[model samples]
Target: MPDSLLVVDDEPAIRHAIVRAFAELTVIEADTAEAGLAAVRERYPDLVLVDNRLPDGEGIELIARIRAIDPDLPVVLLTGHGSTDLAVDALKHGAVDYIEKPFKIERLRTTVSHLLDKQKLGRQVARLSGKASGRSHLVAQAPAMKRVLGLIRRVAAVPSTTVLIQGESGSGKELVAKAIHERSARAEQPFIAINCAALSEHLLEAELFGYEKGAFTGADSKGKAGLFEAANGGTMFLDEVGEMPLHLQTKLLRVLQERRFRRVGGLTDIEVDVRVVAATNRDLRAEVVAGRFRQDLYFRLRVVPVPVPPLRERPEDILAIADHLLKRLAPELGRPGLAFSDAARQAMVAYAWPGNVRELANAVERAVIGAEGDAIRPDDLVLDEILLEQRPAPAQVSAAVQAPIAASSAPASAPALPPGTLLIPPGERHLARIEAMVIKAALADAGGQKSKAADLLGINRTTLYNKLKDIGLEQAESAAG
Candidate 1:
């Protein structure tokens, strides 16, 4: 969609001029301060051009009010009575730029375009860093995760279904919700999300279902559209839904059941086609039993229930997720070509990640910064010592397992050792030392062919190369070849 620009000036000529200049944008006009504020709420413009003086109030004050609604919305002040003090005050009041009367249209266009581009860039950065929307691909290799993906595909086929996602914190509930939306028929529409516990009761009401003009104290005089209206024909993800107030829960239930809602303090009901995806770390069944949550709402939201397995339960995915995280974090942190030591990989697999994927991401970021060499060691991971100590010891290998280790020392021309063979010396519990010995044996068995050695070790060539570098066998491999 083309960006929208709001022109708030009493003079018809000035507004018309700007609209003509920016013919590409959807220009909205407001003749007075009151009308301008209302247009801001309803139209959701990308940029604003307000005359210094309005019929009802000063443009300087309106800038502050517009900022209260959206701190990031770019506002440019146009003044016929140009003064240095007026320009400084306008900026202090939150106007991004102040232009004197009879300004060049090209200059105005340039400023507006720059601000919009900057905002777009900022949003893109936030999305890539996983701070804004959950639109990225999910890394799910474990069988439990595959089951969750299966559920998502089934639910996505029914775009209007209300979904309730239950999972521990940081288990990627929002990501799953986004996946459903992206795969659904309404993928082209907006996918908006809000944390139910972040706002107060009244604010949350106004935010979800927009209020009409003069609805309540401190309310936008020109009533605003709520997230439900903005997210029409798409998905609305309500995070921490279990913490929503009871009164709001009743209203939400109505919206879910009827697909219609009246703005807070508004008489007219607005119908929407938004799919609501509600998620919570808390068990809503318990909350319903305790009378803290509405049973009817709980039933309404759970039309499709998706349970995301925690990181600890999906042990098979730990290393895969870590590698995924590293691929993103490596160059970002200026630590490219980094690899985890065998000990660090073992420790990460053994550690029960209480905080789940979010915690693991943080640990990887920290390790990237803390690692002194190309290899990330156990200390670089900085896992909980107490938890590591409490973990079970490695199981003893049988004679059959020992046979492969013994055969791995054979000459290059000898029969290839069985796939997935690793030589762990008797009574050897040191993970790094055992890993080194296994890599050496694999190299010996393959006659220093890294590719064949990687196949025998059941890993990719890049991973085998990293292992070789970590174990200081790179020089030996070069010499043997």
Candidate 2:
């Protein structure tokens, strides 16, 4: 839907001009503060433009009332007698921008467009953070994840406690942070997240603690509020925080210690009440020992340490998470009612997910897009293919494939190599023995065709030849040829 705008002005000409200017939007107009507040509640416009002089009251007062109704709704105050004091008061009461009378149409349009775009983006961020859909409701059927959830509950009860989440990449560290924020007393406030490793040191610094206007070359002329300032009275999630530069780490330490920070090139400290949740895949203690991280900051952030276990450690969650992800993804991708076959489920549980939840999400998404039938098969998941692509050791391959092979309906005493099939006997655990058995089975299944045997083994002919040489079958194959 196109964005909606609400204009509260006593003058009919001003309202008409705004309506004409924003013809594309569903413009709502009111002649008095009472009508404007009523329109705001009923129309639910994305932005509000109010004139200072209204029939019943001043628009500056309306700004606060409007904020009380919707704190995120952007308001622009319009006035003929514009003064520094009026502008300050409007801003203090929650007006996003102030405009003097006889403002250029283009300038008004640009300002309104910018504010609407910013508000829309903020809503999208909120949705992605799981605010819209009970994002705090995480899947914690596994005891490990349940413990992490318990930690989140305990820390969330304390509004200002700093939390440091340590985990491997893709283990849902940010999700845990969001859970804490959503369950806390500040759930209604903003939750801002930034990746410390994703930006350069200077840019990261400027982003976390905003810079003053013209603080440095290429700075925003109007200056900008950084994530720290934006997340006041809420939560600030610092992801990959171990990668933060050492110099900036000192400033961050100060913020944690004093709850105050100075904008870049600014003299005065700006005090803020923000709960910080920092996450890292790397071990910050190791980084500190190596002089890459601040020792003081490390200790401060570690006050409420929450370690997120890797997906492999919580084996029971594999199928559960896959099912959860499938339910969420199917309808989104226009492929609903898709499910994993029993074999697929066994394969998912057996394979080790080194990339953790992120990889599983990707795998499920790929399956949802590519599955041709109602149920996803093991081939669709391609668990064995992933292992083969990794070029794992023979023993590693055996461990990964053993369970799925056992789950197959093949007879226990079946011939080792039925045509186009290979089977491993029970109680076979030796790596070299299994390697030899698999190769010989492949050769037999291929009718002693070495090239076809290599294809059956999911390896190139050269690799197969080397394996044959290792098992002392090269001479026999050459003689047979």
Candidate 3:
């Protein structure tokens, strides 16, 4: 469909002329502010044109009314030859641009074209702002992320589809939920998230289904409303639902079936109009098989599942995410801003990243703290030992696993070595290599018997085998024989 326009002119001839000029435009005509306001309520136009002097209202007045419905809608004001002052006033009041009655066809066309482009950008900003606070406007261009954005758009239109966001931890499920809520019917309402695994059953129950005063000892004298009640007419995101206890799961399932709950010690049942969007890393279906979760509850929450992929699955997003994080962290860190070095960027894309986004964030935090220059480097990422363990070894590293003391395969460009000499590069020596050498030397002395070799190496047999594997020196089968 072509772009739609609402023309608010007192003269029918003027509206007809505009409609004729932009034949492809869908025009909605209104002669007065009342009619224009009604038109806006009935249909949202992509662009609006208003006469500076309407019979019942000023064009700026209609612009103000339109602003109430959609504050950022682009408006163009029409003015007479002597109404330049009124045109300026209209522009100030949020009309994007103004044109006099005698405006050239070209001038009007150009103005309208520019206004439409501006509106397209506005729509994009509006779309992105639905995600993370402040920076949800940072939209991605990657194909996978583009697909993710499309899913967010389609799913957000539905009011209460419990989105089951599955992803490696730290892949920004919470941000996705926030974006959905921001773009939905309840955009202006509250959005609350409770981490199901973060608290005990009694506390989780008390917090989720609020306890009335004296529901339990040490309770505050005044009772509290639960998150659902507090987030009434909005959204309540139950994060990490896989961690919720069995007893609380039943209450949660009941509330999902009927949006009503009883406070822990209160007689009155409270009803709420809250939409639930839950997220988790655990496979609830598997949990069901394990008898730790309710299948019915799983069905309810998975009404519209949104699985955010792991960072490793979308390594292409690492640079963008890193760029965004750096921009955000710079001012917060009170330091000179930084970005990732090419090597660092390569490292990020190559790493298996088992920790996902949280770990990526921590990695960036380390860079921000340790970096002495303008960009983050591989050296700056203080990865957890576990994550390091999961990463792939260098090509030469695999060779280290095969034989304990092979010729040191140093690159061949160095100065000539002395006859029968071994020269190990600086920083190239490692304990594995040393242990491999010792084991080889000892085995040679012991005539290849592991028991004798172990004694000769001064270590137990199992420890010798472990060292053999560690240093790429597991004995050859024939040699072991």
Candidate 4:
């Protein structure tokens, strides 16, 4: 299908010229801002060309409305010689580009083509990143995971099918969703996700369907667009779908059936073209039998049910996944080039990961921070010691941050502060000064190794670098300097 363009201008001659110039596209024209907005609602165009001065309102004002409707829809401001200021203002309001009136038609055509091409390239890059990141996060060398991968590849080819992913917590259902979306034909579009169990029914309804301005107290005056509108031409991942409110489920079912829905406080029914990918830990069939889930919605979502195996079910993957996590966590935690000892490896494989991959990731992160040496010992695993050794209490962290200079166990050579002087204060300027001091102190304490300093501060090296820049402290600065 050819891409559609909307030209909103008061001048009939200008509109005629624009329509004639873009004969290759399906051109839609409107004479006023009101009519332009109506045309936008009627035909969702890929690009819009609005005159800076419209009969109903300035084109700049319409850009915000256009953005509220579809943030990514490209808009170009059409201006005359003296309207350059208005054109610039329109760009600030979300117009992608501006074209001067009495301009060369070829230049305008080239500009439009270039902007569209750039937008397409951006979407393509986002799609590729989604694919690469999803694949990397999915660590599946075992047969069970390989089977899961195969299923994802197969279903991804069918973009319109609603995929229901069943898995325990931390089994990476979101990763599977991304894989399917990235591989699908609609990869270049958005991938919007929501957790049904995370919000109250009222809030969930508002979030999913949006609301009109001043629909309720504290609502943004400009209103908002919902995930359905945001995810148009892409995929929507509804995590914990079984936990969705019954009334909202009915509304969701309507959208799935008719491909349209009305916002919470709006009368207009908005159309959307999006793929649905739902996931839940609960058995939807059982929920339906118990009368806790809607059968129609359940059946609609389960058209291609994909199950993700828990980490314990694939014991062969225990060591491999641990090693993979360590390779990532070790450097970030400042324990660069650290390795798991033979005993640690053995202990990892022996233990059943009840909390699944998430538990494993936390275990590795903790071990990276608390380990006494370069090699992670069996004792460092701490899986069996949760009951024996209490986790670090809140007081310990508080004391570390707030201890008085005289009370601190720092070396005698360490600079002393005034009695009862708070190292960090609530004020932004004071907090910044104290933060800089702390970074300087950590770098000094770590002998100026950025990674080691980051580890000492319980932050990643990248974060440390950003802080250093913020404090005007060069990375090369040492304790002596």
lDDT of each: 0.82, 0.81, 0.73, 0.77
Tens-place lDDT per residue, model 4, 136-172, is: 2467766788899889878978889999999999888
Worst 10 residues of 1 by lDDT: 402-411
Stretches > 4 Å off in candidate 2? 1-137, 384-481
Q: Write the per-residue lDDT of candidate 2 for residues 207-308, one digit (tens) a residue.
A: 999999999999999998889999998999999999999899999999999999999988999999999999999967546534577878998998999999
Q: Which prediction has more favorable TM-score, 2 or 4?
A: 2
- Native-vs-model 2 lDDT? 0.81
Instruction: List the candidate numbers ranked by lDDT, top first.
Output: 1, 2, 4, 3
Which tens-of-lDDT digit does each residue in 86-164 have in candidate 1?
9999999999999998999999999999987766665557646777522345677677898998888889889899999
What is the RMSD, in Å, between candidate 2 and the native fold over all Cα?
18.5
lDDT pick, better of 1 and 2: 1
Each candidate structure's TM-score, on Cα atoms with residue i matched to residue i, is: 0.56, 0.56, 0.56, 0.53
Output the worst ten-in-a-row residue range by lDDT, candidate 4: 388-397
In model 1, the Cα lDDT at residue 281 comes to: 100
lDDT of 3 at 444: 77
